[model samples]
Target chain A: MNKMKELSVNHLLGIKYISEEDIQLIFETADHFKEVINRPIKKVPSLRDVTIANLFFENSTRTRLSFELAEKRLSADVVNFSAASSSVKKGETLVDTVNNILSMKVDLVVMRHPNPGAGIFLSKNVNASIVNAGDGAHEHPTQALLDAFSIREKLGDVAGKKVVIVGDILHSRVALSNIFALQKLGASVKVCGPLTLMPKHIAHLGVEVEPNLDRALAWCDVANMLRVQNERMDNSYFPSTREYVQQYGLNLERLQKLNKEITIMHPGPINRGVEITSDVADSNQAIILNQVENGVAIRMAVLYLLASKIKNYD
Target chain B: MSQKQLLNSSEMTVTLQRLACQLVENHTTFQNSVLIGLQPRGVALAERLVEILKNDYDLTDVEFGKLDITFYRDDFRRSGKVLEANTTEIPFVVDGKRVIFIDDVLYTGRSINSALTALQSFGRPLEVELLCLIDRRFSRHLPIQPDYVGKHVDVINEEKVKVNWSEDNKENSVILIDE
Candidate 1:
């Protein structure tokens, strides 16, 4: 057989920066890593000589841990830098901080920042490869990749699948990334949430906006519930948590009434009784943990593939 | 690129049969021996060997798997090009088993080195052996040699070895390309 092509970009800034072939390549590589991670040793000496720095300007438990675990699994040395403890607290510029870290000969930088284009900005200035964990609401490319991967694993293919991303579209980096990735791979996407929480021109991105939770759930093959970011909400997106749940929350009753078997997905920190009920979240159809499990493999593939472009790492 | 055929289908078949008979002579039913093919190219030879061992030689109990060493390459960063990974599917345990690493060509033995490191994820084997279709002599950068080699060819740095299988290109041939 012919060799599978690798992603062309040096930096995994966003799903928008990659092509369909790149996405296919990533999924294929992730398949291998997933199998490797399940093995007894659960480690590959792919990046043994490479050094990586995880620079998260924003607080993130899952993404940070996932990237670190992935880096470790690939046998790459990793140094983690978080804003709460780093010089960023001392008001150091992003460039200066990363440059100082790069002076230690870090071959790659996996960053998560509150600013939308922080990763893109660093990729332009930094000498190392950049993997965007989550850059504001712009894109969490790895999350999107893992999400698609989980979908592919569960559904066989992302192509021709009806994926409705329910709840909080406006402030969701996952929604945007998924939209780009799923569409690129031939999945018809829909965004369903309260009107206030929905982003304008989302339909222009080729995703349908179905505000009716029942209608969206009944029409889709999968329902991806997004967390209501109470921390990020500056204004009232909806009346109250109870009201939102009553309208948009996916409960056992709502799920059973749908009559169609739709896979449930949550990016985690699931608002248990809010966006998705405990029963629904814990259902066999819910691949939330699989998404988390596939996250390491996907991140490993991303790091390993991107780090392949780094020079002279004997 | 200029191509010169080294081994055609019939010669390739005879060599593979010889390798299989030799393996049977030593393994004697493949009770504790597992065959691992290096991914992409090596799998073709490994698949053929497994088929010959199972169908022709009547040894149906041999275990076979594919191992990809894309991530284990020492020169990945030096290449400046991203190498896509192939599947590594070793479903059985390798602990205390005689493992034979199969590949289409062995030049620098870097892939075999990577395979050795990669095989650890499965388990520690009783012993590991390298089997290659073509062994390009004097090109190895490491102190490694194949235990079973079908053909040994002397080639300079500018030359390339191409192994094609019937499954891939409707023919089986080993060719040398001068660039």
Candidate 2:
């Protein structure tokens, strides 16, 4: 048998930093993990001796739990730290806090911070491999991977597919990561939202901006609905939540108007009746739940590949 | 490097017939017995044995599956290259049934150890056995010995055994290559 290849980069800071071959390799490895998770015994002993640290300087539910479960399923010892409960509350710096954790001999770090480029900063100052869970509104690499994997599972391939991301493009790490990942994999991307919520010069990123949601929905094979980040906005980007729903909400009536059925996706903690309705989220055309399930497998692939690069000090 | 042929095509056919007969002598009708082939190389050997068992002996109820042990290996970080994974297909239940692990060669006894750990994911077997085409002597790394062997040869640490099959677009033979 031929020898397997390793990933090009050691740290997964963002999708923009990795190559197209890295994404394909990750998707192939995720295919194997997807099969393993369905077996009677879901655990593997590949990372039995490795230790991982999850440092979350921001709040999250799905990303944290998904990374933890992926670590446990691979038989790796995990240590978790949150800013609310850790020394960050006492005014500790990012590099100081990570160096303190590195003193415990952690081999890999999965981190989420409120500031942009925090993972990039930690990767340069730390000795261990870093996986970016989320860095401010910059990028969520694993979420984008799982979203692409979910699309591959539903549509058989992501190449030549039209994907339109709707709502809150200005303050979404998911949107940025997904744009980078999708374009790298040969898919055309479009962003649909209000002018205020859309970023300035987003077209420079090579994505088309569609002001009307209905035209964006009719012109795509997949629709990714992003939640309105009310917490990130200092002032109201829209007049009201009711008005936002009236213009951009994905309801059954709007879906029925489209001639073709498009795959629906949403990264979790969705606001029902805001970006998407409850019925549309639970409909057959929606792959929101499948995205959650694939999240674990995608995370396992990332951890396993990174752990293979950890060399012995002695 | 120099190479020496150990077994030719005619010899391999006879040896496969004998191994099939031995399997039949032990597992009659194969009602509760399953044949598992280790992935990448062992799968070809297992498939050939299963064909002889069905075509010649008229035993059509034999349960067979393929297992991959990449994730269960012990030398993950010790090696220089990354380990690639293969497909594992086990459609039948192995609970309280006999399992016979089939492989092409038994050398160092480490791959079998990994296979043993990988088998637990399916279920517990009543008993387990091993069958191999070639057994390299003095390789008792884990105290594992094949129950049925086609041929035994004394090999050194610097030599490698290469088994070529028709399924891989090569002549059916086994050769020892000096490194």
Candidate 3:
């Protein structure tokens, strides 16, 4: 009965598109899915007849595979589509490619694209339930959810906790999604990075801009170190990788001096020695692997819920 | 919604005693038998039975757990509203054990079918039985019947059966609600 009032939205396009209640519903649902996946028989027959298409216009190994595993665990039929090997190589538009895929009777679409608002555009034009995996520097909702889930599991709750998002904030979809999700869940968010890599007018989003990494680390309950997106940048955002590591990298020495047990998190493909040191990434305090494990459950909850709203399910 | 009382507090107490004695007569030791309550509403009935079986009948070895069938329901998407999932806390395995599925009311028999499907995750049981406080005998959509029924009820499609316990509030009663 409580779930009937929670999660008002069917499509999880972005954190900005969902309310605080919706986030709580997703987290609670994810808790159930997490327990289900831990069992010997991980498969749930909830979405047995539902068919899902994973559309990836950009490169992704972790997020793409995680969604597929989640779909399989829910007993949903899955089809994978990549833009590089598909008709997009022959100059087919995003709408044309997706519509053609939908003609095969796909009920849900999990899309990851290079352009911002690509998911929003497809959702407006397509009939299937749209889950935005990642859209340029816009949002990656599931990553942020798993990040929050890991934090909540470790520190007990997200409310009234301080989180510092460090690294390339301007080009990271992860940072944008994390800020929206954490703030909505009652956590105070701060972004710390090089001034050139930080977005202007970010304070308008109700986030504090802390240029000093030391102060940010000391003040936060959790330090979510985002990867330096080298592929997204056409030119150098900072002078060099050496300088970036020297200024913003989270290492053992700096962590020991913090005088508190701050949870260390990184959305992986870790740069190793750049945004965070290898020792810190592998330390007991790091919840990077837990984020990956929670990612499957989060996506499962998202898919299971959206599949429940499909009108044609038999 | 308007409701009509079916069983009062004293009558409900007598009914539970009868059901508990019936359980003891069927399974004496209860060493290899386990009790599972369907979540959301069935839990209270199962807990009462467990207490009576252990305290009065001295069958203390009986295992009890809660099984949530929210995900296994056939009408989840058809219900048009997302149903909240409850905890499924079957701590011990059910392999080769006599499993009794308990619920407050049995209506269409669809929930028992889903519970059977959900119970497969734990392990295959030697046998399975259904026990309900109120059994709507004529309204079953499937070829299923309860092994132990406290009261047999005849109701139309527009009516609902509600079983309230003293554990939840001050009174214990069964009411038939007209929708």
* Model 1 interface RMSD over true interface Cα atoms: 2.8
iRMS per model in Å? 2.8, 1.7, 2.5
lDDT of 1 by residue, A1-314 (tens): 34546677989999999999889988888998998899999888878889999998888999999999999999999999888887787888999999999999998999999999999999999898999989998999999999999999999999999999988999999999999999999999989999998888887898789989999988999889999899999998898999999999999998889777889999988878988889989999899999999999999988988877676834
Rank order by TM-score, top first?
2, 3, 1
Interface RMSD of 3: 2.5
Record all residue pairs in model 3 with backbone atoms less than 3 Å apart, i.e. clashing.
none
Per-prediction TM-score? 0.94, 0.98, 0.96
- Regions of candidate 1 where Cα sits further than 4 Å from its true position: A1-4, B167-171
Question: Scoring only the second chain, what is candidate 1's TM-score?
Answer: 0.96
* Real A-B contacts recovered, model 3: 0.41
Best-matching candidate per TM-score: 2
**Tens-place lDDT digits, model 3, residues A78-193:** 99998889889999988999999999999999999999999999999988999999999999999999999999999999999999999999999999999999999999999999
